[model samples]
Target: MTEVDPLALDLPVLASLAGSAADEFLLARLRADGHEHIRRSHGYVFQRLIAGAPTVTELGAALGVTQQAASKAVIELEQLGYVERSADAADSRIRRIALTDRGREVVQLGRRLRAELEQTLLATVDPADAAAARRVLVALLAASGGLEAIAGRSVPLPSD
Candidate 1:
């Protein structure tokens, strides 16, 4: 193994790098499976839609983004055949977003890939170290209020 950079010793930097690498790995797998247009950002939308259909405005609020931004993401996903917008049954004027079959498949694939990644990590690290790392990560999330977001399945995407 190569010498680690001193800056990579920082928790936040190491976490970000690890996350990026994991995302790249997942994206590559998705592409190989014919999900070429999917991006990591789409996960934000998918996470919410998995629970139930929500209006763009509602989805925006859940994602902590502006309505227009949320609408843009929905449009992109709709174009990719991952999601669909339909008139709300209660109010035709209102539009609700729902995941299409393709979207659901991607979500399932992501879950499987995530489990595979975790298994790989467990295999690579000592059992005790893996348990400790999981505890530390959970504690960090709790300290940062990320635990709630994750529990609610509405973690916001970073601003561009």
Candidate 2:
């Protein structure tokens, strides 16, 4: 095994580590809540749906995936009873996907767990240091043109 050097870590690497840790924590909590079918990738779709229903094409564009891929994911989510698809009122040709009540519950639970995790971490570090970390992270996010720009990238990046 190669010896790892913490001093070689860069911003992108550190950010990715933070994301993976958060995803692991969230998925573990979701499993405890009886959502064994859900996976980390689905979090991107869920975050988009939480705002309101969006057509598969819109979802695909936001995540930088093909419509077919988005449709496939949505189909699995529908089969699992987390989301539902309906014909768009203004355009019957377009199908809009929305979270079901069960889906909303799952999203809410994830949000609650995330907040709790943040609080717990904040407690572990010095208050000033934690505040500085938040500023740096937020500035990095803003530098990338904010969440909207970040979410438009291809697979594997969590939207929220």
Candidate 3:
């Protein structure tokens, strides 16, 4: 059996490295494709929109940003023609933000880029190890209740 050095390896180090690697991987792929205007934070918003939710203030609360900031981002994206703002169909007085064809294209492309990255990250691992990682990840997220909070509207994140 190989001896493991506990001092040389730690969870914190691995977690930090994993985050940095993921960020670098994403930005490298997306930025190369001329997606410099999209920020990492926009991923959350995109996913939320995909799930059929639309509202700048709600997105702001979930992202821990002010409504004004969220609205600004929406405006910029709208100007880029990726998103559209219109009167809510159900409520004429309220406004809703939706992904235009350009927005959906960006989201789909983002998904493909992320999937490719994930495949490379797990490429060398044994199938059993990969299955275990998936199970552990699911369990950890479920236990943490992070997704549950965000799954519904007006959920919150840590305020900056």
Candidate order, lDDT descending: 1, 2, 3
Model 3 per-residue lDDT tens digits across residues 66-116: 999889878888887778888988898888888899889888888898899
Candidate number of the best TM-score: 1
Q: List the residue pairs that clash in candidate 2.
A: none
Instruction: Please write out the lDDT profile of model 2 over residues 103-158, one tens digit for every residue.
Output: 99898899899999999998899999999988888777877666555565433444
Q: Local error of candidate 2 at 73, Å?
A: 0.7
Assess candidate 3 and give its lDDT: 0.74
Stretches of model 2 off by over 4 angstroms after superposition: 1-8, 91-93, 143-160
Better model by TM-score: candidate 1 vs candidate 2: 1
Give TM-scores for every candidate, taking all chains together and pairing residue i with residue i.
Answer: 0.91, 0.83, 0.77
Could you tell which candidate, 2 or 3, scores higher by lDDT? 2
RMSD values for the candidates in order, in angstroms, are 2.3, 3.4, 4.4
How high is the lDDT of residue 44 in model 1? 90
Q: lDDT winner among the candidates?
A: 1
Ranking by TM-score: 1, 2, 3
Error of 3 at 23 (Å): 2.3
